[model samples]
Target: MKHLKTPESLLFYMMLIREFELKIAEMFAYGKLAGTMFHLSVGQEATSVGTIAALEEGDFISSHHRGHGHMIALGADIKLMMAEMFGKRTGYCKGKGGSMHIADIELGNLGANGIVGAGIPIATGAAYAVRYRGGKQVVLCPFGDGAVNEGVFHESLNFAALHKLPIVYVIENNQYAMSTSVTKSTSITDLYKRACAYGISGEFVDGMDVEAVLETTKKAVERARRGEGPTLIESRTYRYYGHSRSDPAPYRTKEEEEEWKQRDPIKQYQRKLIERGIITENDVKKMGEEIQKILDEAVKFADESPYPEPSEIFEDIYA
Candidate 1:
């Protein structure tokens, strides 16, 4: 299928992402959201939208703690996502998964994991299953730079390459793994180069450029779909918000944040639309309002929905 490069679609997706994060931040401040807060992939919409656009409907994906963008890009129900965050019975996981664990199997989203590097093996296993079943399904696993420090990360890659599993490992190198800089985490600066030692293909691409990421991921996805083993892609992106609500990002300077903000994915895509004449400034404004309206409706649905009954807790849990 041809990728969506139109200005309207790009602007629409970027606005949807911005509005979603805004609503979540608002809800958090209002005491409507429950559980621990994590890093918000607020500025990284282009990378998610571009790569997801290149995926087939039946293909699988594993998301990290900041997974709302992944879910939204894959067409997960916004109302259900909001409800899950609100801990309501109408949620995707029926209010148990919360933000980090939100999932929709029908959409081919295996599940989002709270633990770093947890999804790597899960996606590797999914890839093995696809190969075993003789299906064309591909599994995409996304994790942060910090996850590379985990043993499972290496183990999963080794297993995937050894067996030629159909999977794509994406590292969103947002500069910092929590408060620690990438410089401090790995001796090898470029995360993608590690793929060579594992005897697999690896590439580092600009995560801020939607077009570049989409084009690169298209090739990687095709390679995996062709039964060629996995590809490790390190998307150099950044998070606008702190590691979590508790962090003010004291480790990084205001100048660094400003430098990244200048390359805002939403703005970059919006400008592309204007330059291409796919959408007007008025169109951008209208898109923003539409997404805000959608978010408002989702918030209302979550607020009005009933919380999970006390008895339901024991039903979803296993011994």
Candidate 2:
């Protein structure tokens, strides 16, 4: 495999995402943060981090509801993200867009959508713009398996293929769409095959493996940048948490959860690093300490930030 990124850097990015997510969960559980709802991708960090790592700065990305990892991986400011979650004035959307609606245009994050499959078309439109402008930038659209059933998924793919838009549709298949299992929802379990209908390349990856995700995404990105049509990548990953904060996810079995836990991306990557002698136990400890310090500061910054004034509610409102 070509090493686009060093193993150590990849492992660090995965750990950063994991730790940031864990911190969010802890804060939310203790009422230290405020939001309408939060969808945690606790077990799906590899897909977000690895894919974003493969993209260049100007490349755009459209995120889904469970998109904290996506924003973090794309270099979103942690403090501002935390502030946004807290509804502070210093947030990316000035406290208006909460956990699900955060957007950083300068960072090329089109925004995270709450509605299923909504971001697909937005990303497709962005890709069209890129092609129209003759820019080499690619747009990466990440959504859940549940989104595959949406009409926009097919429409976006067909349009993208017909126009050869520079975009990559990343399906973060976590097996469950809200409480509905993939088997119960769709007959065609192999999501990549859906791309064949658009006459574009499609493939699957071990989403639990950051290296595999990164490598696969890198290839799709290259194809998109080369003016080839979009690529659909079905990443078979899982989420340790529920669809939302209030979900208990009783639809799944404990045995299955435990099995997936054994393949935890962070732990697996740690083992790989150690086995390859890329990082020692001491190095891991230091890295954890550094991440913890960053999280601590992020929380502090968010806590001290001011809330948006009621008089400013009309600000940034277009309609």
Candidate 3:
């Protein structure tokens, strides 16, 4: 099926992303999920939801470490995703991938990478493959602000630009890269300007505004399909939690965090829809209940699912 562009659908997807990540965070807090490295994109749901909404059915996406929202945006099964996080055999990667390594090629998800900036090249390769096959498909590569400093980012962008690859590189600039703020890491502000170095189109977006992201990405996607080139999009967003479960995020002041939360994407969008008469407070309550029920089932499924057997360890290893 094609993208869901309706206001209701868009808002619903954003809500789904929020609830799913929150559930994971809750599970992780309780030590129910596997592994310790869990990154939550709670405040950045709009970026994932809107960017994916701008894509065509045949288009592919390469996601970074904080990629749960990307998969959820593409309408992935929450139960299987939760199972993967639980390291159960029912997961996409048969439980080996854990939270950071789930991949579903059939869904046109090239996969989610644990390494920063690693997915950029994968997306570039997918775009190149699409171009080589003479297909109209495009690729969306989403990474964090920290990934911009990685060497692979520059290399991938240069290659994509040179070949006019059909890819959109989105920097989910949450201002901070781990503990370091973007300002401290980079010399200049407005990361999208880096696109000039590669000679491709660029967009600076409000990651909190889902519709803005959708409209901006639509133009970029259109350009790529016209055989123009890759586009670099810097969607400035935020994270409601620490980098992972370990970091207490002592660096940022309480006031700063509160300021960001004031523009919470889900709440903002819900208000917008409510004001426009597209949805009422009751509608939002019902939607949350629906998503919560799905999440409940996901956790139950993940808990009930079996873990991978020791003997089958190397069965799916291609590399």
Q: What is the C-alpha RMSD of each candidate to the true structure, in Å?
A: 1.6, 1.9, 1.2
Can you rank all candidates by lDDT, best first? 3, 2, 1
Pairs of residues at least 3 apart in sequence or in different chains that clash in candidate 1: none
Better of 2 and 3 by TM-score: 3
lDDT of 2 by residue, 54-73 (tens): 89978999988998988888
| TM-score of candidate 3 against the unseen true structure | 0.98
Which of the numbered candidates is closest to the native, going by highest TM-score?
A: 3
For candidate 1, the C-alpha RMSD (Å) to the true structure equals 1.6
| Candidate 2 segments whose C-alpha is farther than 4 A from its true place | 1-4
Pull out the clashing pairs in model 3: none
Return whichever of 1 and 2 wins on TM-score: 2
Position 284, candidate 2: lDDT: 93
* lDDT, candidates in the order shown: 0.86, 0.90, 0.90
Model 3 lDDT per residue over 213-234, tens place: 9999989999998999999999
TM-score of each candidate structure, all chains considered together: 0.96, 0.97, 0.98
What is the lDDT for 169 in model 1? 90
Instruction: Pick out the ten consecutive residues of candidate 1 with the lowest summed lDDT.
Output: 1-10
